[model samples]
Target chain A: MPQVNMTVNGKPASGDVEGRTLLVEFLRETLDLTGTHVGCDTSQCGACVVHVDGKAVKACTMFAAEADGAEVLTIEGVAAPDGTLDPVQEAFHQHHGLQCGFCTPGMVMSAKALLAENPTPTEAEVRDYLEGNICRCTGYHNIVKAIMAASGQDVSKIAAE
Target chain B: MYAFDIERPTTLADAVKLLAASDENQALGGGQTLIPTLKQRLAMPEVLVSLTAIDEIKGISEDDEGRLCIGAATTHAEVAAGAGKYPALAALAGNIGDPAVRNRGTIGGSLANNDPSACYPAAALGSGAIIVTNTREIAADDYFEGMFATVLDEGEIITEVKFPVPEKAAYMKFEQPASRFALVGAFVAKYADGVRVAVTGASEEGVFRWSEAEAALGSNFSPDAIERLSLSGDGMISDLHGSGEYRAHLVGVMTKRAVAAAG
Candidate 1:
């Protein structure tokens, strides 16, 4: 086992983990931050998306040892300390962005990264950026709408609740 | 994934020395493809030498000859943002897997693994890029051997890749919906002297140069130039996604599309 240290959601965290331990496993099992879901263990399903050094990456695809001494942001750290929801979460709530909610954490993380890069992305851009985050229940209609709304764009043109 | 010892060396020399130290050591670049392979028990390496931390192999720049020089550890996202000099190559990097994948997956990793349907192979072969390793430089033609295979010896690390900018170029891929990998893809690059057409994803022999199409387009430089040209299905990959004949047909279609786009 290797001792790895990283900043998780603004907190310095350290743990002893196997070389093959995935970053997702370290976050969920070791650090007890289960907000980052793993919908598919494979890299295709972006359900394990997290921000490592300001860039969104699949947590399940990277090893914990590889992320040592890095800054990592998970779904648990998205909102304010006062428990107020972030704009993306608020929009998701308002727009019904999730149904079963298995994929909301990843969808939100991916959307946050997208909005950070392109503050005013078009509808097509939003759809394109979320290609990795798959929402099987919502059909992605409301997820797109929520992301657009989070970017302070007009989401009325998007259909559905 | 099976248990293994991991080493993250900040210097390229140290990384190379560690890889050379043990026969079971495997180099890890981004680990986008290799990690998945390891999870399936496909490979068992005793020491995993990670190369992402090496500063020497992590940037995009252009040399005096105007060729694009990309470090091996440079991520796809970095290439997508920095490789503006080569728009076709940048576009291919941008559409590799997805946003997250683009953020983590590196060009060196993609080229080293040499997945048959990988987009970089087409770009490298089409542009006549040179792969610079720790030991020496290898032409794209000599680098790729076959599916999941390359000419790189153990402990030989790809430090950088130099790509010759073409006058006009484009890559067109018919993606397999599930994996987003090219079912059949073609990269068309037109230079001053000649044209190169590299095809991937459709061949059992891995990425290959479509010389007939290249010869036809070299003179005329248009989709109609290779309209009558066709490929044999003898060495084509046939899976549930497509048949050998279907993929063979797609090669022509993608090549035409690539030429039209480049033109």
Candidate 2:
């Protein structure tokens, strides 16, 4: 077993993991942070998307050992400590961005990462960026709208509210 | 996935020593391909030696001669972002699968695996790149043998790939709707000596050069030259995505587009 020491959701965390353990497995199985789902074992699906070192990555495609020293942020980390939804999360809820919600965590994660990088992304760029995250439900039309709406709102304002 | 020992070697020599210890060991670069294969039980290696920690195996630098040296562990995102000096190569990298795949996939892993639908082999072959392995530097023509096959030995690991700066080059791929892997991809390079055209995702034997298109375009690098050439479907791959004949037709279409784009 590999001993991994890393910061999770802004807190120092440590765990012993098997060689075959993936980051998604560590987050879901060991840490019990089951919000990150594994839809496809292949890298094609972004259902396991999470921020490692502030960059979005499909956790399923990465070995837990690979993220040993990295800082990881999951969907659960995006909300307030008081459990209120973040701006992007609220936007998704307000705009009905989710249907089945199987892919919601990943979709929200990808959008958060995208907005973090580019506050105002064009619709085509949003479509291209979210292409990796597959949504069998909602067809992504409202999700794009939610992301645009989220991008316009101030994070500080959302936090104050 | 099967249980296996994983080793993260910090140095090239250490990696070599780890790989030499057992023939059942596999070198892990970015794990975009290897992880999926392992999860699906398609490949079972007793040990996985990760090359990520080795600082020597990452980065893109240029030699005094202007040859672009890309470390084997350099991610597609790095290449796409022009972490190396080549903008065209970066553009090609950006067009690969998607941003997530680009972030985790490495050029060395892609070239080493040599998936028939992969986008790197076409660029490697088209640009006359050199595959620098632990043992020797193999030319692009001699490196790739067949599907998922290369001249690399069991313990051998690709250290870097050196691509000669071309006069002009471009790559065009008809992506598979579902997987986003190339259904038919063509890379065209017009160098001082002649033009080299390579086609991937169409050949059953992996990436192959289009001699007819090359010969025709050697005189004049243009889409018109590609229109005159006929790509045979004799040894092309036929799958649910596309038939051999359809792939052959796409080879021609993509070649014209790539040639036009290269201009």
Candidate 3:
């Protein structure tokens, strides 16, 4: 087993992981960070999305050993140390972005990454960027609105939930 | 996925040595496809050699000949950002899978896998790119064999790919929404010499060049020239998503769209 070391959520995390142990497994099992859901073990569902070196990546598709010595950010890290939700999470809460909440964590993580890259993304850009993250409830309209509102855009004129 | 030992080699030489030490050691690139395949137990390698840490093969540069030289380990996102010299190639790389997938998947892995529905093979074949490996450089023409196949030898690693910038080129993919794999994708590149048309996802034999359409567009560089040239359904792939006839029809439609878009 390879002992993987990474800075997760501003803290150092180390664990002995098998070659087949996915990053999602290491986060959920070893670190007890179950907030990163694994909607699909396959890479299709981006529910396991997390920030690896400031870029959003599907944790399920990457081995724990592959992210060795990297900086990771998970859903659990999205909230401030003071217990305040991140702007993206707050927007999702206000806009009813999630239904079952299974995909919320991944959605928030992916939305953060998108905003970092393109601060003022259009509604089309938000929809396109969320292509990898699947929302089973088909609750994409609110999700898009939340992402847009998180970018400080007005979602009031947009369709209501 | 089965249990295995992974070695992350920082240098290409070390990676080659590690792969040579064990014939069962497989080179892992982006893991976009390999990891999923491993999860399904489709491939069982004794050891996995990761090529991501190798800085030698992880950037995009242009040679003196104005050709785009992309390191094999360069991620699709890197290519999407750096290959602005080749707009068509950049667009193809940018639209691969999605943003997160593009961030992790590499052009080298995509080319090495040569999935029948992949978009890179079409771009490479159409642009006549040179695939640079650890030992030798192989033209895209001789590199791909068929679906899920390539000419890569055991323990071989692709180091870089060189693409000659064409005067005009574009890739239009009709994606199979579920997998985002190209159901029918066409790449058209027109150079000073002639035009090249490569089609993917539709053929069972893998990515192929439509010579008749190329010749038609060589004289008249427009969609109208190749509009009358119909592709045959003999070797087209027929699955639940589409029939051979449907794919064959798409080949023409996509090629025309690519030509128009390139113009």
Better of 1 and 2 by TM-score: 1
- For model 3 the interface RMSD, in Å, equals 0.6
**A63-102 per-residue lDDT for model 2 (tens digits):** 9998888999999899999999999999999878899998
* Rank list by DockQ: 1, 3, 2
Interface RMSD of 2: 1.0
Q: Evaluate candidate 1 and give its CAPRI docking class based on DockQ.
A: high
Show where candidate 1 strays beyond 4 Å: none
Query: Model 2 in CAPRI terms: which quality?
Result: medium
| lDDT of candidate 3 over A22-78, digit per residue (tens) | 999999999999999999888998999999999999999999999999999999999
Clashes within 3 Å, all models in order: 0, 0, 0
Across B12-122, the per-residue lDDT of candidate 2 in tens digits comes to 999999999988999998888889889989888988999888889788999988989999999898887764466668788888877777777899999999998899999
| Candidate 3 clashes between residue pairs 3 or more apart in a chain or in different chains | none
Write down the TM-score of every candidate. Answer: 0.99, 0.95, 0.99
lDDT comparing candidate 1 with the true structure? 0.94
Query: Residue B48 lDDT in model 3?
Result: 95
Score residue B188 of candidate 1 by CA lDDT: 95
Global lDDT of model 3 = 0.94
